[model samples]
Target chain A: MRIRERIIETGLFFSALSSVFITLGIVIILTYESFGFFKEVAIVEFFTGTTWMPLFAEPKFGILPLVSGTLLTTAIALVVALPLGLISAIYLSEYAPHRLREMIKPVLELLAAVPTVVYGYFALFFLTPFLQNFLPELSGFNAISPGIIMGIMIVPYVSSVSEDAMKAVPMYIREGSYAMGATKFQTAFKVVIPAAFSGIAAAFIMGISRAIGETMVVAIAAGMMPNFTFNPMEPVQTLTSYIVQVSLGDVPHGTIEYRTIFAAGMTLFLMTLFFNIIGFWLRKRIREAY
Target chain B: MTRSAIELKAEAKNLNFYYGPVHALKNINMPIERRKVTALIGPSGCGKTTFLRCFNRMHDLYPHNRYEGEIILYPDKINIISPEIDPIEIRMQISMVFQKPNPFPKSIYENVAYGLRVRGISRKGILDEAVEKSLRGAALWEEVKGRLNSLAVDLSGGQQQRLCIARALATGPRILLFDEPTSALDPTATSKIEELIIELKNEVTIIIVTHNMQQAARVSDYTAFMYLGEIIEFDKTDKIFTAPSNRLTEEYITGRFG
Candidate 1:
């Protein structure tokens, strides 16, 4: 029995250590490769230059267009997801009957399970045509359609987490609100939401992270032109999409062009890390407020 | 019984409650006097809290929780527990302070002003006036007056419960229900709450469920001894404490068995 216990303990230790090692390995590789790219392309120019003609004879490797593309899509996605997610979360947590909640939550999660590639086509073929009818200036491959689709894709992440947060709020607080003659809507918005604000904020941050990292939907729907514009109507390329474009294409190994993917990947990592830090700070502040 | 002279705020007539198949409260009949404290004393699972919750139609919040008969609010003469009556309407007139200090995660001022805000009273001056009045009514104004914008959860446990009381009072509720409001509090907090309950009865009718017989004895004008989902005895607090009554009430109050 002791031998078996010892074996299990060792197994678990290795499993935990493996994940740590893998993460450290990725960071090391990304830093190493990005360093190689930065040596050829001036760090200031890569950040400041507007044109991203990396494959041209005189390659300009400005990251702003990709960054703007990411920001615009993420901003649009947040605008769509935040309210819809919170309202749905409130409904599920406060208003839905047990049977209804049980039935609906799984269906909402199933939206997340639907492949992002499928969502990409849905954005390109179905939603784009439907949206173009109203706004004639809208391009066939534009940021708006993909951003909306990405928002729809992330609803489960936001709502599921937010609902769990709302549901975790003790029944007694809600009871206090209800006993004061507050209706379901009023109690949910005024009491429950405030109580679960930290968790809800975390959910919004999770949605933002997912939207920023999301590649396929934007890669397929938003045309991969590195356009330095915030307008959702125009074709734009996000950092993730740019990395995907390079990695999929034939770029020779160990070259400056090949190293750009690592630079983009590192930037993406930094952005997500930045948001996570903000989420951590916000949660602590709200908790202290309580 | 010279019943006609005393003003009654509400009455539970043959009230029965069920949680799914379990009969939680059975054939409860009681008078809630106007501007007086009525204490329900019982052991755990005796359904005292269950009985108090029925007054504000709290059972309606859950599924498979059914109410039979009536909790009729006097003056209005409305059956509060009836399916036709909205729970929110009954709740507007009746508020509850819970066993634990379950203050909303909001500022002290926001907590007190919540009930009024729900009722659509949003004028800043009116809110400020009402918040102060409620805080004063709950005997929490002096300590919290200076830092009303601070988070309510920052207060001690006793203060939080008092804030909840203030929150309930802001609506000017006709009745206040306290379900073991001090059970989670320390001894000093418990005594303060006891004093507050006694003082509060002059304004709104109060119904409190307490496991502590001494609390019932100290704060209540009237007392109901409940055992096994039934009220074993109902009388003046003095009479119930001093005089001979039901064998079970006698045994329960004397700390022989609960």
Candidate 2:
């Protein structure tokens, strides 16, 4: 019996360690390639230069345009997802009737299950054309449509996580607020939301990170032009899209063009890492608060 | 403290409650006197807590919980059970402390001030004063005075319950219900809460449900013994403890089959 139990425990320990091992492996690979890329191009030029014309003459290694594009789409996605997802979470956790909640929650999660490539096609083929008619200024493959679609795709992440956090709050706290004469809305917005603040903040960060890491939709719908402009209606090339652009072509291995994708990947990795750190800190702070 | 019996704070008439089809409270009729601590004592699952929650219509939180009959509040002359009467308005006048100390994840002052803040009392000075007064009323002012902005959850279990009391008190409710408020506390904390409940009666009408017969005897002015969703006996603490009314009440209080 003891031997069997030991074997089971060992199996469980290794299973848990696999996730950590995978993360470490990715970090190591990213760091190794990033180091190789940095040895060729000056780090300052890669970061500070505004132009991202890596394919053209002189092959400028400026990553600002790529980073800016990434930020633009992520910002748009966050703007759409955060409020809509939070409201949906509130309705699911607090207000929606039982049958409605049961029916809608899975459907909301189904959005997450849908392939990102499908979403990319929808953004490129359907959403852009549909939106173009209303606003003539919208380009054929603008950042706005893809960003909006990416936001819709990631809504499940925000809502499901936030709803779970809100649900984890003890019922007695809500009862305490209600006993003090707070209305349903007041209790939900004030007591429940504040109690679940850390979780909600973590959810927002996770959603933002997901938006930043998203590749397919931006690759398909957001144009390959690395314009550093803030206009959502115009085409822009994010870090992920540029990587996709290079990978799709027959760029020989060990070339500067190939190395630039590593540099961009490192930047994207760092940005996501920063968000994850914030989310971790918030989750830690809330653990102390409760 | 004794007050005029005629000056009833709340009265229930044939109150019956059901969770779905299962009847939880059966024909509960009682009067809660003004400025008196009334203890509802019974075995587990006897509907004592349900009866207490009915005072503020807390069961309305979930769907399919049916409430029959009327809970009348005096001075306001309001029927608490009527659909026309808003539950929120009733809750403002009658607050509750739970079996477990469930303070909001906020500072002590904010927890106390939450009730007032929800009612739109935004002035900093007014909020500060109310926080101090409510904390003092709950007998936690001296201990917590040093860190008014410290998180409520940082405090001890005893202090958390006191914080919850302070929270309820800040709303300036006319009645306070304690649903086994000291069940999760230590003996010292339990005694402190009992004393606090008695002290609070000078300002607010008190309705407490307890499984401890000794606690009910120690603090209550009026004691109601409930058995299987029915009030087996209801009388003054002295009469209920010393003499007897129902044989079932006697047997149960004397450690017979509950």
Candidate 3:
């Protein structure tokens, strides 16, 4: 019995330790490889320059176009996800019948479980054509289609977390609102949402992080040209998409072009890290509040 | 004993409540007098809170919860618990303070302004006047007047409860329901709430459910002792406290058994 217990404890310890070590390893490698790239390309120019034709004869290495693409897609995704997620959360938390909520939540989450690569294809082939019927100027491969699809892909992350936050608001607070004659909509918007603000804010940040780090959908649907424009009608390449594009090509391992992926990976890592920190802080604050 | 006829605010007639298969309140009948305090006192799970919530149709918020009779509001004569009557309409007239200080995680001003906002009262001058008046009514104006923009949760437990009372009063509700409003407070906070309750009954009709017998005696004009989902006795507060009533009421009052 003692030996079995020891074995179980050891297995659990290693399981937890392995995740920490893996994360540490990723960070170490990112910093080391990025260091090599920064030595070859001026760090300031890589960050601030507008052009990004790393493989062209001229080889400009500005990251802004990729950053803007990531930002543009992320902003568009938020436009779709924030309202859709919060409204659905309110419905699930306040209005939907218990059995119905139970049935719908898992089905809604199954949206997240759908392979994101499939979403990429859907965005490219289906959504782009469907959008073009109305938006005559839209390109065959544009950020708008992929950005909207990415938004739909992340609705579950935002809605599920937000619903849990709103639900975690004590029933008594809701009763107070009802007792004052506030309708369900008023109570949800004016009282429950505000009460659960920290958790809801954290949920928004989680959704943002997921949108920023998403690779497959944008890689496949958002045309791989690194264009430095805000107009979603034009094709653009996100940092993740740039990395994917280069990784697919047979760039020699130690070349400056290959090292650019690591540099881009580090920037992506930092952007996500910034939002995750905010999410973590907001969650921590809420823990103290309740 | 002879007594004057009292003007009634509302009454529950043959009210039976069920939580799924469990009969929580059975055949309850009671009168809530205009601008007076009616206290419900009983042991835990005796359905005191359930009875208080029924006045505002709070039972409707949950699934498998049913009310079989009527809680008729005065002047309007609307059956508060009727399925045909919207609970929101009943709630607009009747407000509640809870067992714990459940403020809306908003500023003190917003907390008081919430009921009015629900009624679509948004002009700044009107909101300011109403907020001040309601805060004064709840006896919290002097302390919170300086910092109306601060969060209600930042207030002390007792102050938060008063803020809730102020929120309830802001819309000039016809009746106020308090469900063990001081159960989570310390003794000093409890007395402040008790004093506020005494002062509040001069305006809106008040119904409070309390576990403490002495609280009912101190603050209520009328008291009902409930046992096992039934009102064992209902009379003047002094009469219920000092005189003979049902055997169970007396036993519970005397702490012989719940």
Candidate 4:
């Protein structure tokens, strides 16, 4: 029995260690490639410079445009998703009849199953033209279309997580609030939402990270030029798309452009890491004993 | 029995509650007097809590498969079970303290003030006054006053129960329903809650579900003994305790059977 227990303990230890090793491996690769790029590019210039035309004859390595593009699309996506997803989550968890909730939840999750490429094509082929009529500033391939599609893609994550958090709250608490003569809306918003604050906050932050990390949808529809403008109508190239564009071309494996994309990958990784840290902190620090 | 002009705060007549197809409460008929404490005592699964919950229509949260009953609330005399009557509005006038002390993961001040906040009472001075009054009413003011901003979960179990009571009272509810509020507390905390219930009878009509016979005898003006989803006997506390008209009530109160 003791030998069997020791074997099980060793297996669990390796399982935990594997994740740490994988993370260290990715960080090492990112640091190695990005370190090589930094030798040619100044840190200040990478952060402050506006253009990101690494393929040009006079290669400009300012990463701000790509960062801004990533921020813009992610912000738009979060703006579209956070409230819509949270409200749907509340409705599904708190208001919907149990049978209806069961029926609708899987269907809402079905949105996540659609390939990101399909969402990209749909944004490029269908929504961009449709939106162009209303907002004539919209181009054939713009951040707005993909931002909206990415928001649609991420609704399931926000709703599922937020709904789970809200549901995790003890039912009697909501009942207590309702017993005080609070309307369903008031109980949901004021009581359940506040009780589930950490969970909902974490879900929202994860949504931001997911939106920032989303690739194919933005790559297909958000254009190729890394424009720094906030105008949703203007085309913008996010970090993920830039990496995709560079990798698709014949930039030699050891070339500066090849090294440049890794720097961009490192930046995306850092931003996602930062968001996740904040989310983890919130979830961990919650004073919810009940 | 000089009860010609006594006003009733709430009344339930031929009320039946169902959980899907299972009848949880069968034909409950009772009248709640204003400014009085009524205690419902019964064995587990005898529908004591279900009857107390019907006062505020708590089952309305899951309206899909809950109840079939007419709980006629006095003053308005509105049929609380009717589809047209908003349970939201009914809940505002009636508040409940649960068996387990379920305080929100918030500060003591916020926990007590949430009910007032829900009613759109945003004035700081008013909320402060109301929170203080309610906490004091629940007998938790002196203990919690020094650090009202502290998270309520930091409090002891007894204090959490009082905080829940204060939360219920903060709404200035005309009627307060308690479903075994003291069942989770220590004996000392239980007595404190019992004393608070006696004091609260001056302001609000209260219906309590308790397994503790001594608690009911001490706190309640009226005692109801229930069995199998029906009230076998309900009478003045002394009469129910000393000489219950029903054999089951006498047997149960005498510790012969539950």
lDDT of 1: 0.92
TM-score of 1: 0.97
Model 3 C-alpha lDDT per residue in residues B1-258, reported as the tens digit of each score:
333588889989999999999999999998888999999998899999999988888988888999998888998898999999988988888999999888887899999999899899999999999999999999999999999998888999999999999999999989999999998999999999999999988888999999899999999999999988999899999999999468888888899986
lDDT of the candidates, in the order given: 0.92, 0.91, 0.92, 0.89
True-structure Cα RMSD, model 2:
2.4
Predicted candidate 2 versus true structure: per-residue lDDT over A1-290, tens digit per residue: 99999999999999999999999998888888889888988999988999888878878888999998999999999998999999999999999998999999999999999999999999999999999899988999888999999999989999999998899888888998888888889889988999899999999999999999999999999998899888999999999999999988988888878878788989999999999999999988766545
Across B1-258, the per-residue lDDT of candidate 2 in tens digits comes to 354535799888888999999899899888888999999998899999999998888988989998888888988878898888888888888999999999988889889998888899999999999999999999999999999987888899999999999999988888999999888999999999999988999999999999888999999999999988998888899999999779988888898966
DockQ for each of the predicted structures, in order? 0.77, 0.75, 0.77, 0.71
User: Residue B27 in candidate 2 has what lDDT?
Assistant: 91
DockQ of candidate 2 (2 decimals): 0.75
Cα distance off (Å), candidate 1, residue B62: 0.9
**Any residue pairs clashing in model 2, and if so which?**
none
* TM-score for each of the candidates: 0.97, 0.95, 0.96, 0.92
What tens-digit string does per-residue lDDT give for candidate 1 at B1-258? 469988999999999999999999999999999999999998889999999999898898888999999888999899999999999999988999999988888899999999889989999999999999999999999999999999899999999999999998999989999999998999999899899998998899999999888888899989999989999999999999998379888888889997
Model 3: CA > 4 A from native: A1-11, B1-4
Residue A62 C-alpha lDDT in model 2 = 88
Q: Candidate 2 docking: what grade? A: medium
Q: For candidate 1, write residues A1-290 as lDDT tens digits.
A: 99999999999999999999999999999999999998898889988989888888988899899999999999988889898898899999999989999999999999999999999999999999999999999998899999999999999999998998888888988888888899988998898888898889989998999999999999999999899999999999999999999989999999888998998899999999888888778667655434
